[model samples]
Target: MMPDLPEQKGFLEQEANQFFEESFSGFLIADEKNRIIRSNKRVSAWLGISPEEIKSKKISDILSIGSKIYFETHLSPLLKMQGYFEEILVELNGAAGKRLKILINAKESASKEDGLKLIYYTLVEASDRVQFEQNLQHGKSRAEKELEAERENVILREQLIAVLGHDLRNPLGAISMTVGLLERSIKDERQKKLLQILKRSSYRMNELIGNVMDFARTRLGEGIVISPREIDLKPVLEHVVEELKFLFPDRKITVDIALPEPIHCDADRIAQLASNLLANALTHGNPQSPVSFTASNETNKLELSVANDGEPIPESLQAILFTPFKREGNRPSKNGLGLGLYIADQIAKAHGANLSFTSNEEETRFIFAMEC
Candidate 1:
């Protein structure tokens, strides 16, 4: 199967020439001065120029303006120092203002005899890969911009709620004063009942306004501000119970307090917490059953609880019970802003206490416990 030495050498030379002409990538040979000594047919096809015209031109002649600067300033120096470079991204100028993206590899020929230097280059088209990278970068920028805009909108909306809640308080105060003045002169039985209704509605509105302002403040990151001191919490709880009983005369609310010592807490805030809990029970508990409220201090631990007979809280709702603006969706009365329990929980947290609850077919109970 062996051929003669002269015939084997000829066959190898023919095979190498065939491969050089048939390669998919563009090819070029340049001297040390950077002038193209030879270029393949593929290079002529890519640039829309004839092979005869491409020869003797500098390699930078076909590069885009930006790529030309990069080659002279960075790529060329790096190639000479390292003797080779591969997979460098660059763009070539093509016909009709088109840009042909390509990955280029270049190397200096190993032979350096008689001061002769040659460089070989291979250029591969990379249009699809480059376009995909550009698209990914564009999407990332758009998402970041959208997220920043949403954050600004949320801050603006919370500020608006705070301003509106503050302005409404003055007018609300005037209405309450007018109702008080009219109550003193009213004597008719039916008229007195109507006045009582107005009084209850005004009281409810006041409670709602307070909750709105608190909600906005907390959402805006101000949080619940409290001043704690040693105080008798029993009277505070009792006062809240009496106020709620007056608000709903037909409903019965039972209370038991056995605090023998003062506890360190913000009295006004504790009263507000108790009031919110009592109001929620009156609104949602079974009409025929009485709400049970109890406060006690045992071994320096303060524990307060409110319980009432009612339908058990839904499993799904219990998870978000302390989240603002959420309420029992199936309940008949949806009059509130649903911030009562949320505000109460926040107040407890501000005082380093825990507010927890339990619900079942028999009763639903909320307990607030803290160390005195």
Candidate 2:
């Protein structure tokens, strides 16, 4: 390519210089020591200084105290190491103590013979961007604090429930004892019937209390406690099925057990889990069909299942069936507090076992599997 004529070159140079001075952003030319050698018209106007006045002034002179320190300690060293720097945020001090947040870009170019090699800088106003970042940081901090507070509130609520559940046990026991004694002394048939009703209601209340306490214990991070022992689970399974039958005499229950050897387990908790599953089956089973209980203690593992024939549980409800306080849509909410399955599942987990279920138009079954 051939060089342009001098007049034509002068015209292009003038046009380029005009665009550089009148551009929207600020621009500066500084010597190797960071002394301002020249500045564009826009920068001079924004800082309330003429181009002539800005010349020979150190960049530190136009920066806020903090920015001045950062520029010298970090920005300068980084620019020296990399020969280029971009988007380095700095607060520029202007006339009348005004401050402007700006993003700076600095680059080292070829040395000039005219006077000294210079650093070229470009600055963009970043007040809004800085404010946006600050707002984001503030919102993040607020969310974290709120989440922590919510967790504490849940812990406190669980503690209170546990305390209340514990306190009710003594009075409940007294009431149960009194009711039994009253039944023994009563002679009238009607009075005996009333005592029976009282006993039933008391038993139900006691079960509810137990559920609440267990829920509290789990939520408060103290899981269900168990005392494991070597024992045959056949009798335990039979007794639990018998108890459920006694509670709901109208409901038919069938039990099949194959435990011929001792199994290490917490019998009380196992019985509770069995009762819970049976009760659920009774609540939702086909009235004419018998609820089935099956247990097998093979050499490797123990498996127990409770099944009843009825309408299939809704698919959505099945997903959360073992979560606390959630009842199936078709089930009566007034019948119980909706904790039976949840407590049973938790007990299974504590025992290093699993409680699972399957439901269809024909039947719904809750099955427990455990290591022998």
Candidate 3:
């Protein structure tokens, strides 16, 4: 000022310079005619130019074609009317043709009083952020394509398995009937014993074929047709337990049904769910230990659980237990293709239910629940 103002003004200027240099975003000062008056080091670095060299240059000279068009059409009009614009994405071209995506924010400076506007701009490079987003989108697209292909493959494979199982059943049925007739016709004890062996083998083959077909039907979404009728679950659970007892005669299994009377659900699908879960428990659980089945009604949902005292599911295998063909630990001496839980899960989901599990060293329980 007219008075001595050198020291105080110098201190303020020094602070401003320090602030500008420390900022990561590029900063520029331009006069009303869009001529650069001053620029920070960040801006000079971004444009691959000396700050002094850019002092008299026009702002449009460094913008890419698209960015220039956008500035002319949208930013200039908005700035003229509003005195500022914020966070507009634009591309800047460097001296050697390097391109950078930048988020630009501009505002008119209040200190300009010569009937000329002084504009201040901040530029933030968004190249890395944009690249990351594109990569994420690409990964998502790839995963979707792979999932579609896998679904198609599963459908084709299941169709073939169903056809093979059907064909095998006819021949196996004839062989069993022929063996029964031979058993009655034979006189020698040894011959009778041999025919008995043939009968047992045929029966075992039939069981394997049946399992394959059942698994295939479930995998290909053709297993059960649900007719949403008012059906009770107590009787279905009892029937499933009885059938499982017959299926695994050697294994000791216990069934406990504790519902508040009649509970409505998709009867056939619910039965299939129960049957699959019990079958899984019987197949994987220790024969000496008892498998437990329980059902109850809670609030607006019906809950069912199948539990077994088996070797604990390993931590590594627990994450993907419901995925098709995912098997863990030592395979049970019983031959299985590892689709029981997978089928149970799908059936539960189709019926608007969720399948979940809990496991420890002593017991493993798989639970399914649906709206009552």
User: Candidates' lDDT values, in order?
Assistant: 0.91, 0.88, 0.81
**Residue-wise C-alpha lDDT for candidate 1, range 20-122, written one tens digit per residue:** 7678888999998679988887788889998889988998989999999999999899988999999999999976779999999999988687879899999
The residue pairs in collision within model 1 are: none
True-structure Cα RMSD, model 2 = 2.6
RMSD of 1: 3.9
Residue 219 C-alpha lDDT in model 3: 64
Q: Using Cα atoms with residue i matched to residue i, what is each candidate's TM-score against the true structure?
A: 0.83, 0.90, 0.60
Q: For residues 128-238, could you state the per-residue lDDT of candidate 2 as single tens digits?
A: 999999999999999999999999999999999989989999998999999989988999999987887778778778888988999999888888988999998888889
Q: Residue 118, candidate 2: how far off, in angstroms?
A: 1.1
What total of clashing residue pairs does each candidate reach? 0, 0, 0
**lDDT for each residue of candidate 3 in 1-372, tens digit (9 for 90 to 100):** 386589989999999898897679888888876788888888888899898899888777779998888888888889888999998888898758889899899998775466667999898989998899899999999999999999899788889999999999998999989998897889999997788678757855765676577678776767644567776678778887886785576887777787765765677767877887887888778788999888888787888999999788878888998887777656554455666677678778777789999989889899998887
Report how far off residue 243 is in candidate 3 (Å): 11
By lDDT, the candidates rank as 1, 2, 3
The total number of steric clashes, by the backbone 3 Å criterion, in model 3 comes to: 0
For candidate 3, the C-alpha RMSD (Å) to the true structure equals 7.0
